[model samples]
Target: MGRSFEDARRWMQEGTKAFLDAIGLLHGDDWDAPSGLPSWTRRHLVAHIAANADAVGNLVHWAATGEETPMYSSPEARAEGIEKGTRMSGGELLAWVRDSAEKLEAGMAGLTVDQWQTTVVTAQGRTVPATETPWMRDREIWVHLVDLATSTAFADLPEDFLEALRADVADKRGEVPEVFGTLADVTAYLAGRPYDNVALANGEPAPDLGPWL
Candidate 1:
């Protein structure tokens, strides 16, 4: 069976805590270091994650109140927020991220069964039920934790989550690689990260995959 709303919420909570713990370990210079993502420093990534919680929480509010609360006013506004967030000091950034995460958790907790089923628009312009919010946040926190490049690797993720992620990526990417390894390795490769451990069928390296959602 696929994951339920409760299951996704639990994983989202766990992933949030793990990501925050990893962020807490960053030293003075470490915050400015380049993360696994191109053109984004650790600060930029954390800020984006923090803002995402607030944005997704907006959808939850819409679900509960039937108000039309969009995640961001515009795509340009979203980009501006991230750029402005990068200027915050490390301590400020950490605090904002934690507080925003807490706000999102509280919002989700207040959702009733009916509210969970209400349709809301995602930042990507897709209209999905509020129940999907948890899984959306789950994917963001879990994947971005590794993208932080703070010693956490795909191997550290829960095996079940890795399996789900692999299937999801495969479905979205349309072409799955023939490489073989643990689900974590395949997931990492599919996520557009270099995985030295995966071996191709013809004894060559895994081919570069296109961007995933």
Candidate 2:
């Protein structure tokens, strides 16, 4: 069954906490280290995650007010925000991330059922109901936690969440492999990440998947 907004909100909170805790383990210099994402450092990933919270919050505000507040003024502005955030000192960036996440959570908590059902635009340009916002935030923090490369892995995710992720990725990619090791491995593979630990059915290498939003 699909998760309710309350369930999704709980997951989002837990996932964001886990991601924040993982990031807390990193040393100052680790911010400059490369993340699992290509061409993005830990700093870049952190900055993006922080900015994403504020952007999503904009959508929440729109849903509540029936106004057309976009997640970003433009794609360039969004990119520029991340770039600017990446240059902040480690302390500043961490504070920004924590503050933004807290604000978003509080905003979500205040939403009425009618408000949650209101339509809003995603940063990717797709229009979805506000109830979808929690799941969107859930995906961001959970996936980016692994991308942080700070000791957390997909295997560390809750089993139920892993199952949901598997289904989500499968929906996007289609054609599940016959010999996947774990739900986490399947999700990682479907998300277009390296799945060195995933065992193929025919002893062949994992196939390259197209980008997944």
lDDT minimum window of 10 residues, candidate 2: 172-181
lDDT of 1: 0.87
TM-score of 1: 0.94
Model 2: residues >4 Å from true position, as ranges?
174-179, 199-203, 210-213
Pairs that clash in candidate 1 = none
Clashes of each: 0, 0
lDDT of 2 by residue, 98-173 (tens): 9999999999888888899999988877889999888888888998888888777888887777777777777756
TM-score of each: 0.94, 0.92
Itemize residue pairs with steric clashes in candidate 2: none
